[model samples]
Target: MFFNRKNLEDHDLRHFYKKLLFPRLVEERMLTLLRQGKIGKWFSGIGQEAIAVGSTLALEDDEYILPMHRNLGVFTTRGIPLSRLAGQWVGKDSGFTKGRDRSFHFGSQEHKIIGMISHLGPQLAVADGIALAHKLKKENKVTLVYTGEGATSEGDFHEALNLASVWELPVIFLVENNGYGLSTPVSEQYRCANLVDRAVGYGMEGILIDGNNILEVYNAIDTIAQSIRQKPRPVLVECKTFRMRGHEEASGVKYVPPHLFDQWSALDPLLNFEKFLLKAQIFSDIEIQQIKTEQKAIVEQEISSAFIETEIQADIQRELNDVYASSVYTSKNNGPSKENSKRYIDTISDALNLAMERNDNLILMGQDIAEYGGAFKITDGFVAKFGKERIRNTPICESAIVGAALGLSINGYKSVVEMQFADFVSCGFNQIINNLAKTHYRWGEKADTVIRMPTGAGTGAGPFHSQSNEAWFTKTPGLKVVYPAFPDDAKGLLLAAIDDPNPVLYFEHKYLYRSLTGNCPEDYFHTEIGKARLVHEGDQCSIITYGLGVHWAIEFQEQHPEYSIDILDLRSLQPWDKQAVETTVEKTGRIVILHEDTLTCGFGAELSAYIAEHCFEYLDAPVMRCASLDTPIPMNKLLEDQFLAKARLGSTITKLLAY
Candidate 1:
C-alpha cells in the first residue's frame, strides 16, 4: 500500500501543521479579497475543513474529486494552486474555466476533479460513472464525491447512490451534514434520524463521524478508500459539522441564533486542532506559530499575484475561440436502396448493432435496454450479441444513466443513452442541459455521446409518453438534434450521430417505428448530419419538415398534384440545412414551416424568423407554419387527431395557396 494505518497514525508534526493551518490561511485570504472587491461571492468551508482536507488525503493525485460549491478545503488538499483559484474568482482567462465560470465552479480534466455545479447533486452520479470505468478497466483507484446535508433530498442524490450500490462502484460519498441546509434545519428535510441510516437501504456500508476532528476523518476515509480500491464498493460517510458562515459571503446569516452560532464557533476545527497538537506535544507553541505564519505568507503572495494577472488590460473577447468543433463526413450512399428493405424499428436496431460491431468503444445504457431490449424492443437481441457489459440494463434512473454516459464518454468511450419515451427526458434535464451540453464550451471537455429520444404522438400513449421535444435540444448550444423520417435516414443518421464529436440528441418518432418502411442498405452506411434531403423537388411552394411531418407533407403533395411543391426533410434540427431552406424558398417564392410540437417557440419559429429575415424580398407571401395546438396530448384518439390532422393541414395549405 502506498499509504497505510501506520503512516497516518504516526501523525508527523509537518503533516498535522500543514493540514490544520492551510485552510485557515485560505479563509482569511479569501475574506481579504472579498473585502477589497476582488471576489464577488465566496462560500467558505471554514468549520468543515477536516472533512475536506483529511478525507481527501485518502485519494491519490489522479483520482477524481467531485466536490460541492463550498468544499474549498478539498481544493486546498488536492493541491489546486491558490493563485489559479484566485484567478477564477476574478474572471481571468488564466483561470480554470478560462474566464467562463467563477467561485469554485471549475475543474481540470487533467486533475480529474469535476467542476462543482450550482445544482450539485449531478456530480455524484458522474463520479459513479468514473468509478464504473475504473472497475471495468481493472484500475486500482477510487472516486470521491462530496454533497451537502440537504442535497440528500434531491432526486439525483438517491439516483446516484442506488446506482453505485447496484454496480458496487468504488465511490465514497462524503456528505457534510452541517446541521442546516441553507436556512432550514435538517429536521424539516428528512424523516430519518440521521443521514447515515439512508445507506443501509441502498445495501452499502455507512459511517457517521465528527467532521471537525481531522485525525478521525482521515482515519475513517483512508480505511474505507483502501477497502474500496481492493474490493470495489461504495461507502457513505456522514460528517457531522457546522457551517461557520452563511450560504455565501453576501448572505446575512440572520437566521442563525446567536447562542447556537457561538457554540459551533467555540468548536472551530482549526482552533480546536491547534490546541490538540499543543497538548499532544506534536509541536511547541512557537513551532506551530511559525507554520501558521509561513502558510499565511504563501496564501497572501498567491492572492497578490492573482490580482495582477486577472486585472483587465485589454478587450477580453476572443472572436476566433470556438465553443465547440465539428467534422464533415462525406457519406456516400449507393445509387438507391433495395426495394422493400425493412421497417423503421428494424433499421434502427440493425444500424445500432452494426455500429456496435464496428466500434468496440461504443456501449448502450438505459432502463430495460439489455435483456428486455428497451420498452419498444429496439435493442431486443443486444444482450446476447454484445453481453450485459456493453448493453447495460441500468436502474430506472434517467438522471444517473445520462450523467454516467457523460462520464463514460469522458473516459474515451462512445455511449448511447436511450430514454424510453421523449417526455421522460425532463427527468434528466440537468445533466443534459447543464453538464453534457455546456461542459465543452465551459471547460473544453467533450460529451461525445448520443441520446436516443423516442418522440412524436399517434400511438395513443397520451401526454407523458407522447411529445416531440426537438426544440429543447435545438435551443441548447453545443448539442446536435437529429430526427430521422425515413428508414434509410434513420439507419444512416444514427450511425453518423454516434461518430460525431459532440453530444447529439437523436429523436426517433415512435409512431413510425413499424408503420414506416424504406429501402435502406443492410450494411453500415453514413448519412451526413446537418444536411437536408430534398425528397421531392418542385418550384411552386416548399414544405420544410422532418420526421412525421415528412409523411404529412407527402400526403399534401399527393392530394394537391396541381401545385408544384418541394418537400424538404431536415435530418438535423440544431444545424438544420439553412442553405436548402434558402434555395427551396427562393425557387418556389413561397414556404411553409411544419412540425408536430406546439406552435409557440418550436423549432419552426426559428426557421420562420430565418426566412423572414433573409428571404423577405424573394417571398411571394408571408411564410406559413403548420403545428400542433399548444395543449397536452390527449388520451382519446379523436381529440389527438383533431389536435393536428392531415385534412386540417390540407385546408391550411389550400388557404395559403388562395392568399
Candidate 2:
C-alpha cells in the first residue's frame, strides 16, 4: 500500500481481502458474461471496490447504506446472498424487485440497503431523512450514502448536505471520486481542489483518503462512524480513486489517456493490497492462492445457481396490481359530535393537530412551518405544541425536504411535507414523480407521506405563486390526489391523506383558506377518498368540478336559479368517483366539466374524454369544458379575474343548456 498501515488485526485484514476480492472477481466474471452475450450489461467496479468494501465493512449491520450502480462491493459486503444478487442482474423473479427493475436500482428494507435511483443526487436527501429518523428515535444508527464525483454538481447534493448540517443529522456523505463521470473528467465537473472542501461550506467535517488503500479507508470511516454515533453530525469523505473500466461495459474507455491509465494501473487497489499482505506476512503465496481459488469457486457456484433459476413469467395482471397498495375507502366518524362552524384553514390545522396527537410517528416539515406557521399560517403554533423534533422548520430546499420525507417514511415514520407554494414544487418534482411516486411500485415500499400543496390562482400572487397544479401529480401513478372545496371536506380529507398508506398530494386552495366556512365535527373523522359529494342536486344540466371550480359552479347556480344544475364536487381526482359521474351524465344528458387549470389538457380534458367515450349515448350535446384561458395568471386584479374560469362559467353552462 502507498500509505502507512493502521492497527488493523491480521484477522481483520484477511476478512477485508476476502471481501474485496469477491467483487473484483464478480466484476471480472460479469464482464466475460457480457462479452459472451450471457448477460445484458455490466458496470464494472474493477478498481474502486476498496471504497465500497471498506466503508460498508466499517458500519454496523443495522446502519443503512445507499450505494450507486458501480458500488457492487457494498451489496457483497453486506452479506446479501450472491445467488439472489445474480438473479437480480439476470432479471429473474427471485430478485429484490421481482424483475421489475434491474441491477442495483432496488432497495431492501430487510437488509437496510437503499439502492440508488437513476437520478443520483436524490438519494443523498433520502439519506438525510433516514439519518433524521435515527436521531429522532435516539438510535445509535448512522446512514452512509455514496455518490460519484460528477453528481456533486447536482442541486440535491448541496441541498442534502445543507439540510443534514443544519439539522445536525447523523450521515456519512461518501463521494467515490473515480476520476470521470461517463468520460467527463473531474476538471470539467467542479473547480474545487477536492470534493471534501465543499463540506466546509456546509459546516461539516471533511476528510480525504487514498481509496486504493483499503486499510486507510476502513480506519478513517470507522473513526468517523464512531464519532458520529456519539455526537450525531454529518461528515464528508472524498475517496480518490480511478475508474479502471468505462462507465459501462458497452462504453469503451477511449477517452482516458494511456499515460493516466498506466499511472493508475501501478496503484491498483487489489494488486497493492495483495502486495501489502505478502510484505506484512499476513498470508504466504500459496495461502493467498488457495483463498483466491475458494472465492472464485464461490462466485462460480452462485452464478451457476442463478443461471438455473426460473425466469420471470409473463403476468400482466400481477404487474399492474403491484402499482399501488390496496387502499380501503371508508367514511369514518368517531361518534356524534356537536357541529362547529370553522374556516377552511382552521379545519386543516385542527385535522393535523388531531392526527399528530393520535400518531406519535407523524412528522411535519416545511419552511417557516414551526413557529411562523406556514406561508398561510396553517402551522403557526405547531412547533410549541408538537416540539421542534416533530414540527421541523426546514431550509429552502424543496428537493432535499421531499426526499427526506421519503426516507423518513422508509423508517416507519409518517411525514407531512408542506410546499410553501404549489408552483415551487417544480424544485422537487423529480423526487415526487420518480422517487416517491415509484418507490412502492418498484420495491413494495409504501411511501406513507402526505405533501400539502397550497394551490389555485385566486390569490393574485402572479404567475409563479398562483397555479392549479394538481393536474401535474394526477397523471403520475402510485399517487393519490385530493382537492377539497369546503372546510369539512378539507379536514376529513387531510385526515384521510395522513392515514393513507400511499403518497398523497393534498391541495388546499389558497383563496379558500379563510373564505369558505362549514360545520365540522369536534372529534376526529375521515372522509372517504375516491368519492364525490353531491353539493347541489338537479337534473337539467350537470356540473362536475373540484377545488375553486366547485365554488364557481355553486355561485353561478345561486345567481341563475332559472337553470336547473347538478353540482358534483370530486374530492379526489386520481381514483375519482366514476360511478357518481356516470350517474349524473345519464340523469342530465348535458355536461359541463369545470376546472381552474388551463383549457388544454387540463383535468377537465380527462373528464370530457371519459364522458365522451363511456357515456356517449347519454350525451345531449358535445361535452363542454369550462376552464381558464391558456395564459399565465396576471398580477393585476382585473386581468387575473379575466384569466380565471369563473367569468366563463355562465357562458359554458348556457351553451350546454342550449345544446
Candidate 3:
C-alpha cells in the first residue's frame, strides 16, 4: 500500500492508475465481447493487469517484449488499439493475424512486441533470440518475456535461461504466478515453492514481488532493465498474482475448488490495488469510478470502430508466404557443381566442411558430432576441419542444444543442429514443435535457422532409435521439412536448407547414410526447394516418395520396367510442389504414396489425401499408400525389415497395379 519501497510519489501513483485503467478496460471489454459471442474463445488477464501495465511502462517503446496468451494487458499497455484487439478476437480484418490466429494472439512489430506459441516455453527462447539479435546488431535494447508460472517447467525454460546467462544476453524473464495452468495447480507441478528460485540453477538472479502492487512490478522491471542495459545479463522476476477467472472461456469451475478460488479471489490484484489507492487517499471512490467509466467508454468506441472498419479477408495465404526467406537461400555457388562418384556421408561431410569454410556465421553443434563425427559418422573430419567455435560439442541436453541453436540462429548466424539419433528427437520435440516451428510465423519470419536430424527405422536399431515421425511437423505450419534421398540431393538440399531464411527440419534417412551411394557432385550447388525430382518416367503409376524411398523406387523401377513405374521424390514437404505432384499424377493416372514411417497418420496418408483432393479426376484408382506396418521398429534385423515398408513394397506395387 505504501510507495516507500519503490520510492514513488503521488503523481507517479496517478500515472500508474492511468496505465492500469487502460489495460483493465481492454480486458473487461474483451471479456464482454467473449460473453456476447462476438469474440471466439478467449483468455482473460483481469486480475493480473497491474503486472502487465507496470512492466511495460518501465521500458522504452523500442525495447522488445514477448507476451503470452494471457497478457492482453501488456498488449494494451504497449499501445495496441482496443479496436484492433477486438477485431483480432472477433476475426475481423483489422486483427493482428487478419482474423487467422485466435483471439489474444495479437502481435505488433511496430510496438516491438513479439508473438509466441500457444504452448508454454517458446516465448523464453524467442525472447533470448531477440536479446541475442540485439547484442549482435550492437543495439542498446533489452527483451522482456511474459509467461505463466506453469511454463517454467518446460525444457525450453531452462535451456533458454542457461544459454542467455552463458552468453550474457540482455533479457528479463517475467513470470506471472496466477496459481493455475489450465486445471493443473503449480504446487503439484514442481517442487520449488518459488518460481524465482528456479533461476538460481542457471546462474542468474531473480526476485518474487507482490504482483498486486503496481509500484513493485514497475520498479522491479525498471531495475532489471537498467541492469541489463548497463551490464547485459539475464534475470527472472516472479510476479505472485492470482487468476480471478477460468483459464479460458470454455473452462468451467468444475476443476476449481470453491475454497481455493475464494482465497485467491480475496487477494485479487485489481481489487486490492483499487482498495490500496482508496485507503491511501490517492484517489476518491467517485474518481476511480469515473476513470473506470471513461475507460469502458473508450473500449466500446474502439470495438465499434473496429467492427465498422476492420475487414476480415483470407490472409492465411501469408501462412506460406515467408516460410523460407529469399535472400538467405538465393546465393552464389561456392563448391564444384559436377557429379562425382561419392557416398551420402561424403556429400554431407563435404557440405558441412565447405559451409563452415565459407561462412563464419555457420556453426555445427550436436552430441559427439565433433570428434566422434556423429553417430553415423556423417560429420567425420568436421572438428578437424573447423575449430571448436564452429564445430562444437554439446551436453546431453537435447532440448537445450536445439533451444540454444534457436537462440544462435537469429543472432545473425546460420546454425546446423544435429540430433545424434532421429528417434532421440523426442527429447527436443518441445523445442522443435513449440519453439522452432512457430517462431518465424509469430515474428513475421524473423527467425533464420535450420535443424539437421537423422531419421528412419532399419538395421535393428530398436524402437527408440528407429522411428520416422516427420508427420509431427507436417501438421505444424510455418516450418520447412526436407527429406533428401540421394547423395546429390543431400548435398544440394543441405546447402539450400542452410541458406534458408526460416527454420528447417532436415531429416536424413539413417539407412541411406552409407548404404545408398550416388554420383554426388564434387562441388557445392543450389537446389530449388519445394520441387519434386522425377527420377524415372512412366505412365502406369507414380511412386511418390522422399529421402531413401526415391532410391527404393529407382530400384523398383529398374526391376519393373515392363510396368513403366514413375518415381517422384518430394524434397520439401511444407511448400511441397503441388504442381509437380498434380502433373505427375495426371501423366501416370495411378499413384502410390511411399515412406518409411508407420502407416497411421504418416506423410503418405497426407500425400494421399492431398492428391485425392487435387488430382481426383486424373486418378484411375483410389490413391494407394505403401508404408511400414503400424508397429514400432524392432531391434532384430530380420524383424525390422519385416516391420518396415521393405517387405511390403512388392505387394503394394502389385495392389496399385491391379487397381
Candidate 4:
C-alpha cells in the first residue's frame, strides 16, 4: 500500500534515487566542462530536480513535455540517452540538433518532447495546442509544460491558461517557482499571493506544493494526470522551490543571500532523500552511496566521451536544405493551365474545403470562421460540412492563434490560420517572426503552417485594415510568402501552400477577393510556389509585381497601347522565381518594380539590388519603381486614390522606356 507523501517504498526508492542522482551527476559533470572551457554555459537545476523527475515519472510515455533549460531531470526520466544530452552541451556532431542549436533547445517528436523556444512563456500556449490536438483526436493523452515563476509575468502565461480553460484542454502548466527568473526575484514579479490561484480566473484548478519534495510532486501529478486523461482540462501547478546555483555556472551567487543558500542546502533534496532511505529502511547508506557512484560514473563517462567527439562544421549549404520543401508540381508548361472559372473568394473557400477533405490533418481557425462563415463570408457553410471542432472560430487573440498554430504544425498538423486582415498580422508579429519563421532553422523544428493574410488597399479599408505587409515577411528566411493575382493562381497557390512542409504566409488580396474573377480550374491543380507567372509577354520592359500590383501593371499596359512591357506576377515572394526574373529582366534590358507597399526598402529594393549585381551588363537603364508613398494608408477618398500607384503606373513605365 502507499504510505504518506515524502516516504517511498523499496522499489519506489530504487527508481526515485536515480532521478535525484542523474541531474545532480549531470550538473556536476557540466560544472567540470565549464572549468575546462569545453562548454560555453550551463543552467543548473540542482535544487529543482524533484519537480522534473517527479512530474516526468508521473506522466505516461505518449504524454508530451515542453521543458525549459532547468528541467534536466525531465530529460533523464524520459530515457534520453546520457551521451546525447552531454553531446548537446559539448557541441558535438552527435547532439540532437547535430551542433546546429544550443543545448536544452532540442526535442524529439518520437519521444513526445517539444523543443522549447527561448521565450519560455510561449511554451505553455504551445503545450495547450498539443493537448488540444490530443483532445480533438480523442487520444487519452496529456501535455506537461515547465516555466519559471518570473516567466508567468509574460502575457502568454495568462493567454495559455485562458485558452486551455476555454477549450478544456488536457494540459498541466507547471510553474517552477524557484524564487527567480534569472536575476529577477518573484517578489518583484507578481503581486498575487500565489501563482496557482490565478488559474481559478481561467476556470481551471490549481495545486501549490512543496516542489523540493519528490514524492509530493510525483503523487500530485500521478493523480492529476489520470483525472485529466479521463476529463480533459488545464491544471496550473505551483512548485515552491529554490535555485541552488546562479542562473548559469558563470553567473555568481552575489544576488543570493548566503544565509538563504545555507537554509536550502540544509534541506537539500538529495541529502534529505538519503536520510529518508536510511530511516525508512528502503536502502542502506552503503547502497545509497553505490547508486550515487553508479550515476556519477554514467554522467562522467558520457561527458568525457563527448569531449573527444568531432563537431559537424557549420555548413552554409546544409543550413539551406530544408528552408522550403522540394517542388511538388511537375508543370507540363511553365505556368498553370486553367480550364474552368471560379471567383477569387470561391477559389479560396473551395481550396480550403478540398484541402480539408483530402488531408484530415489540415485544420482551419480564425475569428468568425466557424458558424459565422468568416467576416467576408469566404468560409461560408464550412462549419456545416467540417463541423465546429475542425473549423474553429477563435477569440480575437492573434498571438495565441499563431503560436498555437506553430505548436500544431510541430505535431504534424497542417495548421491553416486566418488573420482577419493582413494589417492585423502585426498583432501576431512576434509569433510569426520569432517563433514561426525561426523554428525550422533555429532547432530543426517543423513549422508546417499556412497563415492566410487578407491584404491590400484600393477598396478604402484605410491604414488598420488595408495595409500590405508582404514586404515585412519577404525579408525573413524560412518563410514562404505567396501573393497571387488572379483567381486561378489563388486557388492553385493556396492548395500548394497547404501541402507545403514549411511555414507559408498566403496573402489573399481582399480587394481582389470579390473584384477579381478568372478561369480557376474546378479539378485538382497546383501552382508551383517560387515561380513567376508571365501574365503578358513583351520585349520593351519587364514589370515585376505581385498581388494587386499585377492588376495595376496589366491596367497600365491597357491604358498605354504603345508601351510594350511584360508583366511578371511573382506569386511566391521569398523563394521568388529569380530565374524567370533574370531571364525577363535580361531580355527587356530594363525593369520596373511595382507594389502596393511603400517604396522604401520594399520587395522592389531586393529586386533592384539583385538586378544591379547579377544583371548589371544586361541593364539598359536604372530600374524604375512605382509604389505607394512611405506613409500609412489614408481613409480620405482622394488621398487613398493618390496613395495607390495604379494611375501613375503608366508614367513610371513611360519614364523607364524613355530611359
Candidate 5:
C-alpha cells in the first residue's frame, strides 16, 4: 500500500510477466549464440526487457520505434520473428537484412521499426525525423527512440530533442538508464541530477519510472504516449534500470566496481518482475518455469531454422538499389554552359543556382549563406531568388542543422546543406559519421544528401574556423567525399553530387574562392561523378593533388617549364580515378600525393597507399606525399603559410628529383 503499486489482475500480471521474460530469453539465446560463434556479436539486453516491452506496448503498431543494439526485446515484442532476427545475425538469406546486418541489428519496414542505427545518439535525431514524416503524412503515429543514459552526452541527442520540442512533434525520447554507458558509470557521464531534467532544458515533459516494475513502466509511458497521440507533443521518459551482464561479449567486468555490480544485479528487472508475478499468484512457479522453457526452446529452434532459411538473405545488389528514384534530367546552363567562357566566379554561382533550378526538389540550407550570400558570397542573392522555402536559414545548431538535412533527404528532398566553416563540422560529427555515412550500409534506406563545407587555412580565421577534416569522412563508407580546386570542376562536381543518389560531402577550399579563376561554360556539363580531372599533362613526374593544393601544383608546374610534370586533380576522393592515377604514374615513373589537410592519415596518405600496392610495378620511385604539418592550423600568417603546403613545389620536386 505504501508503495502505491496498482492492483493489477492476474491477466494483466500475466501480460506483464510474459513480456518481461521475452528479452531474457533473447539475451540468453544470443549469449549462447555468441559462445557457439553463430551470432556475429552484440551488447546483451539481459535485464532490460520490462522497459522495452512496457514502452513499445503503449504505442500503436504503426508508430515508429527506433531502437539500439540492445533493444532486441522491443523489436521481438513488436512481432518480428526470432528466426528472421536469427537469420540477420548469421547473415543468412533468411535474415531481415538479407545477411547484411550483424547480430542485434535488424530493421523491418512492415513492423514500423524503420531503422536500427547501432551508433548511439544519431537515432534520437532520426526518431525525430520519423515523427516529422508522420506529421507531414498527417498520420496519427508517434516515434519512440530507445537510447542509453550515455547517449545524452552526444550533441545529436541534444540537437534532436531541442528541435522536437521546438516543433512540438509526436516523439518520445526514452533513455534506458542502465547505470553505465559501457565502462563509464552514469555518475561520471552526466552532470545533471537525472536525465529527465534534460527534457525541461528542451521545453518538454519529463517522466521517470521504476524501470524494474513492468506495470509502472507501462503505466507511465501509456499516459504520455496517449497525450502525444491527441496533441503530438514530445516527452522524455527515463527508465531507471540496469544491465545485469557485461556491456558486450568482448567487454570484461573487471573494471566495474564490485559494490556497484552487486547493487544493480540485486535489482535486476527480469528477476524482479518474475518474482512480482509469482507473489501476485498470477502464475504458479510451474507455469513460470514452463514459460521460460518454452521461450528458450523457441529461441533455439529459431536459431536452428535460421541456418537453413533462404528468403531473408539481403540482396547484395541492394547496394545498387536507391540511386535516383526519379529520373533527374540534366540541362546545360546557357548562363554558364561550356560553350561560352564566363568569369570563373560567375560560373561557380551559376552551377549551384542552375542545379537548384533544374530540380525543384533541391533545398539549400546553411548559416548566412542565404541573405549575405555566404562569407565568400557564393550563395549571395539565393534567398531572394529561391525564397526562404527553397533557401532557408538555419539556427547555428550544426548538429541539428545536418540532422534536419538528413531527415529532409530521407523524405525525398535532395538537400544541399552548407557549413559556414568546415572546422565546426566536428560539432555535427555524430550525424555525419554515424547517421549520414552509414545509412545505406546499416539500413536499406539511401541518404541522397549533400553537404558543402568551407575548408583550408589561409584566411587566418584562427583555429576555430580554419581546418581541413576531409580525411574524417574519407574513412567512412557510404559517403562520396570530393575536394575541388578549380571553379569549373567545382561547378560540375557539385552538380554531379547533387544528382547522385548517395550522401556527398563536398569540401570547398576557402582560399580558392577567388585565388584562381577560369572561364566556365554556360551549359550544364557534368564532370563525371567519380572522375578525376587532369589539370596539366607532362612526362617528368606526376603530382597528385586536390582542393586548394591543386591550384598550387598547377602554378608550380608553370613556373618550372623544364620539368614536365603531370597534375592529376582527384575531384572525387571516395571512388577516385584509379585508371588515371596508374596511367600518370606509369608515364612519369615518379609520384607525389598532395593535400591541404594534415599529413597524418590525410587523403594523400590514402593515395600513397594505393600507389604503393597497385601501381608498384609502374613506379620507378617510391611514392612521396606533401601535406600540411601534423598539427592544428595556427592563427598567425607565417604559421598558417608554413602549415598550408605552400612549398608544395620545392618539397615535391626535390623528392621526385631524388627518386
Candidate 6:
C-alpha cells in the first residue's frame, strides 16, 4: 500500500524491477567467485538492494552521490558497465583505480560518484563540501552521502551534519540503518529510539522509511530531491532495514540471531517486488521469468569478459609518476627588479587579495576568517571585499573543514584553508594524509588546495599555539611543503602555491609575521617552490635552515663578522633545493643543519643523512645539526629561549669550526 502502481507507468515499473535485479544477480555471482578463489573479497548487499537502487534512480545524472562499500546497486542503477565493475573487483587495469585500490574505494568523476574511503564518516564531510559548491554556484543540484549505523558514533558525522545544517546546504544525509555495523547490533550503536531523531538536534528535517519496500524508497527520495532543489537545505533520511549477510564474505553471520533472519526473510526486497508486479498485473508470470533470465545472461557474459581482460602490470615508473599530479617548480631568482617595502603578514594578505581577485573560482575557509579576519588578522577585511560566500567562516570543526576543502578542489574550485595554528593540524590529520594526500595516487583526481599553517615559536604562545610540524606533511607522498623567511619570499611563495595543481602546506612563521620586513614587487609574482635562497655567502661553514632558523643563522653571521658562513634558506621542504644544498656543502666543506623542531626525527635528520650520503667526499668535517632540545616548548620566556636552537647555535658552530 505504500507504493501505488498508478504513481509509475507500466514501462517504468518493469524498468525499475530490472534495475533492482541486476545488482542482486551481480552480488550473487560475485559471492560465488569469492568462494572459487576468483575474486579477493565481497561486501554483499543482499537484502538492502532497494535503498541503493531506489536512491540512485531518484536523482539526476549531474547530481553527485557518495556511496559506501555495500552500495553496488548505485553503480548498476547509474548504468556503469557490469564488465568494468567486475574488473574493479578482480583488480584489473580496466577498473576505475587501475588496481591501486579495492572494491568501491575509488571514485569516478565521469560518473559523478565519489566513493567512500575506509574511514566512512569523512565522506559525509566531503558531501557537505560538494553541496557547498552547488550553493555557491546557485546550481540546482544535490549531493547524497551514505553512512551506516556504526559510523554515526564518529565525531566527523556530528561535525558534518552540524556544518551542513548551519550553512543550509542542499544535501541529503542518508543513514542506511541495516541493524548491524559489522558484528555490533543497533542496540549497541546508539541510545536514540530512531536515528532520524538525532536530525532535530542539528536543526534539520528528518524522515524514516521502510527500506525493504523499493517503491516507497524511490517515491520518498524522488520527492525529497525535488524539494531540496527548489529550496536549498539539508535533510537527514534514515532507512530502516537489515543486513542479510556478514559485513563481508570472509566474515560469517553466526553472531546474528536466527529468529531475526526468519522474521525478515519474508520481507526480501527483490522477491516481494516481483510478487507485487505479478499481483498488480504490471507483469505476467512468464514476463517476470523472462526478465530474470535476461539479467542473468547479461551478468554471466560481463563476468566472463572481465575475467579475460588484461591484469594490472607491475610498472614501477608508472606507479612512481602517478604519486603527484605536478612536478616541483625548479626555477629560481625570478622576481621583478622593482620592489616596495612591506611586512611579512602584509605581503601574505596582498598575495591572497590578488589571487582571489584574479580567479573567481578561488575561495577561502577558516575559523573567524570572514568577519574576525582570522586568528592572526591576516585576512582582515577579506569578507567585505570578497563577500561571505567566497570568504567562508567555518565552524571550529577542523576535520570537516579540511574534508570540505578537498571536495571543493575535486569539483573544479581552488580552496585555501587556514589553520588557526599549526599544532591544531593534528585534529584534521587523517583527512590530510588519508584523503587529500592519497586521492590523486588512488584515482588520479587532483586536490588543488592550500592549507596555511601559522608555524614556529619565539612568540611565547606555548606548546599548543607555537610548534613546527612541517616534517609530518613532508613525509606524506602527495603533498608539497613551503616555508619562507622574509616578506618577499612569503608573498611570492604563497602565490606559487596557489598556482600549483596539488595540495600544498604553506608554513608562515609567526615569529617573523610582524618582525621581518623586506621589499616585494608591486605586481603579481611567484617564487619557485623547490628553490633555496643564499642569504649570506661564505666558505667557513654552511648553515642549512628554513623558517626562523634562517634568521638565526644570518644574525649569528652579522654579529661574528669573522667566520664567513653560507646561509642557505630552504624555501620548500618536500622537494627541497638539493642542488643548492650540495653546492653550498661542496663550497664550504662543513655542514651545520638547523631547525626549530625537536632534535629527534626532525627535518634536520633527513637533511643530515642526505648530506652524509651525497656530499660526504666534499666535507671537511662531520655534518653538525643544531635543533631544539627534545622536550615540549615552555611558556616562560627564559625557559623557552633555553629550549630553542638559537640559544645553542653559536656553540654548535664553534664546535663544528674546531672540527
Error of 3 at 364 (Å): 4.4
Which residue pairs overlap in candidate 6's backbone?
none
lDDT of 3: 0.78
Sorted on TM-score, highest at the top, how do the candidates line up?
Answer: 2, 6, 4, 1, 3, 5
2 against 3, candidate with superior TM-score: 2
TM-score of each: 0.94, 0.98, 0.83, 0.96, 0.81, 0.97
Task: Tell me the whole-model lDDT of each prediction, alpha carbons only.
Answer: 0.84, 0.92, 0.78, 0.84, 0.77, 0.91
Q: Which tens-of-lDDT digit does each residue in 263-370 have in candidate 5?
A: 877777777777766776767899989998998888778878887775543454665543223224354455543445554456667878988889877878777777
Best by lDDT: 2
Instruction: Write the residue-wise lDDT of candidate 4 on 142-198 in tens digits.
Output: 899999998888888877788888888899999999888788877788889999989
TM-score of candidate 6 versus the correct structure, residues matched by position: 0.97
The residue pairs found clashing in candidate 2 are 373-379, 373-380
Q: By TM-score, who's the top model here?
A: 2
Across residues 322-376, which tens digit of lDDT does each residue of candidate 6 receive? Answer: 8889745533234545688999999999999989998899999999998899989
- Residue 519 deviation, candidate 5, in Å? 3.5
What is the per-residue lDDT of model 2 for residues 241-299, given as tens digits with 9 covering 90 to 100? 99999999789999999998899999898889999889989999999999989999999
**lDDT tens digits, residues 1-659, model 1?**
01222454435545855865787788877888788886788887888887888777767888888888777777877778888877887777678776777787767776677867789788889888788878777888899899998899999999999999998999999999998888898888998888999999999999998888877888888889888889999999999999888888788588888887888888777787777667767778998889878888998898778878845444434412435655566553466545457999898998899889988878899989988889999999899999887899888899998888887776667889999888999999999998888877777777888999999899888999889878887988778899999998899899988888788899999999999888888767788888999999898788899989999999878877888889999989977888989999889878888889988988999999999999898898889888988898897989898776343677667767777
The residue-by-residue lDDT of candidate 3 on 197-250, one tens digit each, is 888888899889988677788888888888789888999889998877788878
RMSD of 3: 4.2
**In model 2, how large is the Cα lDDT of residue 268?**
91
Cα lDDT over the full model 5: 0.77
The candidate, 2 or 5, that scores higher on lDDT is 2
Distance from true location, Cα of 584 in model 4, Å: 0.6
Tell me the spans in candidate 6 whose CA falls farther than 4 Å from its real position: 327-337
Clash pairs, candidate 1, are: none
Candidate 2 at residue 47, lDDT? 90
